[model samples]
Target: MLRYSNRSIFGIMEGATVFYTVESNNVTNLHQFNQELRNLFDRLRIRAASDGSSRKFAAGNSTGPYPATIYALMQCTPDLSKQDCDDCLVRVLGDIPITCYGKEGGSVVAPSCFLRYGISLFFEPTDDTLQSMGPPPQAVLPPESNGANATIINEKKRNASRIATIMVVAIISFLILIIYICIYLRVMRKPIGNSETTDVSSADSLQFDLGTIRVATNNFSDANKLGQGGFGAVYKGRLYNGQDVAVKRLSKNSEQGNTEFKNEVLLVAKLQHRNLVRLLGFCLEGSERILIYEFLPNKSLDYFIFDPTKRAQLDWARRYKIIVGIARGLLYLHQDSQLCIIHRDLKPSNVLLDAELNPKISDFGMASLFVLDQSQGNTRRIVGTYGYMAPEYASHGKFSVKTDVFSFGVLVLEIVSGQKNGRFQIGENTGHLLSYAWENWRKRTSSNIIDPIFKGGSTTEMLRCIHIGLLCVQENIADRPTMASAVLMLNTDSLTLPFPTRPGFFMNKFSESYKESSEFIQASANEASVTDPYPR
Candidate 1:
C-alpha cells in the first residue's frame, strides 16, 4: 500500500502540480535513512545539472544500516534547462519532510522532474558493474572414456572441419564472381559523357505518364488544388490503385531547364527520412514537369501555426516537437544523407504535417546540391522568401549551410512567438522580429517575446528555444550552430550554450537590401525571384 498526497504550492512553483507517494512501512532508523536520502538527492541534483551532460538522469545507492541500503534515482526531462532541473529537485527535496518523513520508501513526481528512493534495489545494474562482478563459472565435462575413442573423435572432427572450410571458400568465391560481374555490367551500361543523363535514365522507372497524372488530378481541376507557390500549384490526386499523392505541377515559364528539373527530381527521390517528405515519382512529358509525393492529410504547418484560432491546438509540447523535427530534417539533408543538400528555402509553408501532426519537410525546388566535402557555394540568381534569408546570402549571393540555419532560426522564433518575422508589431513598437527578440534577450526580458497564449507552458523550455533561435540567426557565420549542433541543443538541457551575437539583417535591413537588389535585377537581367513578401 502507498500513501499518496497532491499539493499545489504557488510559492514553490506557480500553477504547477506536485504528486508524491510514500510506503506505509515505517523505517526503524528514520534519522539515518533521512540523512542518506538527503545526500543522494544532493548528488543527483548536481549530476543532472552538470555542464555539457546530455543525460538528466542519475541513480545511486547509500548504505543506511547493517543490512539496509537506500537506492535513489532522480531525473528531469531532457527539455528542461539545467537551472530549472536543479530548482525542481530542490523543491522536491524540500517536500520530503512533509511527504516521506519516517517512511522506508517514497517517490516525488512533478511536471518536469521526478525522484524515487527505496530500501531495495529497483534498477538493473550497469554493464560495468556486471563486468566487475566477474564472469560465471563454466561447467566441466566428464573425462573421456578411453584414449582410442578420443582419437576416433578427433579424426572425425578434423574431417568435418576440412569439409566446412572447403564449402565456405567455394561460397565466397562464387559471391565474389557474381559481384564482379555485376560491377562490370553496371560500368558498361553507364553513359560516358554526362553523369546526369545516367541519373535521369536510372529514374525512368519512377516516371509516370501524363495521362495517369491527369486522370488522378481530375485534369487539374480547381477543386483539386491544394496550394500555390512560386514554382506552381499542388493538387491532391488519387491513383487508380487507390493510393493518394500530392502532385506538384511546375509552371511552363520556370527558368530551370528540362535536364536540370529532371536531375533535381532524381536527387530528391533518392532522399529518404521520416522527417522528409517522400518523393514517389515524376512526370516530364513535353511542357509538363510534374513531381508526385506522398499526400499528407493534415496539410502544412503554416495552416495551423499561423491561424490564431488553430494556433492554440499546438501547445508547447507539440510546438517543441515540430521544432525538433524540423531541425533533425535539416541535419539529415546537410550531413546524414548520401548527398549533401542545402534547403535554400525552409519555412512553415514548406513543412507538411502528417495525421499525427509530425513535421515532414517538403519543397526542394530551390534546394542546392553540394559535394560531400564542399561547405559553401556561390549563386548569382537569389531565390527565397524575404526576412528568412541570411544577410550574406541575400546581399552578396554567397550561400552555405548557415544560410538555411538562419531561415530555421527565423522559423523557430515564429513558432515560439506565434507571429511572423518581418513587420512584427508589439503594441506601439513596430520592428523586425529579430531586432525585437535581440533587444528582449539583451534586457533579460526574453519572456516578453513569447506568445501570451502559452500562459501555463514551461517557461524555461520556451526561453531556451528562443536562446537557440538567437544562436542560429547570429550575423557571424561562424557563430551560427550547424543543424546537428542545433538538434543536440534542442534535445540536451544540461549543455552549456554559447552566447548569441547580433542577428543578421537586424532592424529590417534585409527588406531594404532585397528591394534594392530586386529593383536592380529588374532593370538588368530580371532574374531574381522573391517568393514571399514576408517570411512564411
Candidate 2:
C-alpha cells in the first residue's frame, strides 16, 4: 500500500494545485503534440448533455467517452451527464477566486456535481464521499536536557554550526533544482515548433524549378498576388498543363514558413481527401521555395461570413449548406480519412468554398495527426486565434479529435448567428460570442442569439442548430460529441438535443468590466469596430 500524508503545510503560502491528471496506464488518448489533449478535453466537456435517455454524457461504466476497459470514468454528479460535468467545470474555473482561495485538500460540490483534488490518498470509489487514508504522522524530536554539561553544549555548538553550513549548501542546491524545473516546464509549455526547431521534415517530393514558377507567375508581380498569410503571399499561375494553380512564396525572413512548408509537403502530400486542399507540387531552388496548389475560385469562408454585403449572397440555405459541408470535411479529416488529423488552426479563413459553393478545408501547415485509436495529447505552445480556441487547449496545451470538435462548435455558432465569435459585441457586455450565446441559452432566450439577417427563417431549425453548436463548445473535451455525431445531428431532424450548459471562455467579470468601460462607447459609436472577434 502507498503511504500518503494528510498533514497540511503551516504557512501563509498557498498549496500548489496543478490542473492535470495521471492515468493508471501510460496509454493516454492525448497525443503529446500540438496541445491535442487540452483541446480534446474542452470538446468533451461541452458536448456532454443531461437530457433524459439521450444525455450526451452518460454515467454508466459502459458509457461516457471511449471504453470502460480504458478506465474512462468522468466524475460529474449522478444527475449530470458527462456533458453537464463539463459545463460545470468550465464555469467553476471562472469562479476560482482571482486570488487563490481553497484548502490544501478540499472540493467544490455543486448541486449537480463536485470538483476535487487532495494531498492525501483518497479511495477511488464510485461516489461523492471520500475515504481518507488516515490522520497525519507525528514527528519525533530530540528530548530536552538540563545544563549538566556545558562542555557537551560547546561540542554540540560546533556540530550545529557545521550542520547549518551543510543545510545552507543543500538549500542553494534545492533552489537551483527548482529553477531548472521551472525552466523545463516553461519550455515544455511552449508550442511544439518554435524558431529553434526551424527544420521540419523535407521528404523528397515532386519538385518544381524556380525558373518555371517565376515565369508562370510573371516574376510574382503585384497583379499575380492572390492572397497573403502570416508566412507568405500566394500568387496565381498557369502550369505547363494549362492548369490554374496557386503558388505560395515564403518571405525571406520567415522561419515559421520554412518549417511549415517542409512539414506540409511531408505530411499532406500523401494525404488524399476531398475536403483537404490539394498540393500538386512544390519548388526548392536557392533562395526560393514555393508550394503549388489547385486554386479555388472562391477564397476562404471568412470572406463571405464576415462581409455584410458578401454575406447577404450566402442566404440561410446556402450558409447552412456550407456549415454542413465543412462538418463533412472535418469528419473526413478526423475519422473517414487515411489520417486522423486535427486542424489546430481551423477557422473561417482556413475553409475555402469552390465555385459550386462546396466547402473545402485547407491549411495543413499547423495541423497534427494521430493514430485512430488515440484520443488526446498535449503541447508546449498554443497557436490558433483566441475566440475560436477551446479553453483547455489555450490554457493547458492539450488537444485531440475533441479539440477540433470545440473549434467546429465555434464555427457552427458563427454560421448560425452570422457573427464573428472573436469580435462579437452585445449591449454593454464584451465577451466571446460563445459565452454570450450561453448566457442567453440558460435564460431560455436563445432566440435572441440568432443573427438578424435570418429574421424570417425557420425558428425550429435555427434553435436546433444553436443547441447543437452549444453542445460542440462544452467545457469538457469528453462532453463534446464526435464529428460523426455532429454530422448526424445536422443531417437528421429526428434526433433530440439536450440543453447546453455553456461554452468555454465565458469570463463574467471581464464582460462586466468591459460593459462599464469608455472604450466600449467608442467601439459602439463606430459600426466598423463591431467586428467579429474571430480572425476569419
lDDT of each: 0.74, 0.59
Q: Cα deviation in Å at residue 244, candidate 1? A: 1.0
Runs of candidate 2 exceeding 4 Å displacement: 1-205, 251-266, 366-374, 426-431, 509-536
Quick one: best lDDT, which candidate? 1
Model 2: ten consecutive residues of lowest lDDT:
527-536
**Candidate 1 segments exceeding 4 Å error:** 1-187, 191-198, 366-373, 508-536
TM-score of each: 0.60, 0.55
**Model 1 steric clash pairs:** none
Model 1 scores a TM of: 0.60
Model 2 lDDT, residue 125, Cα: 26
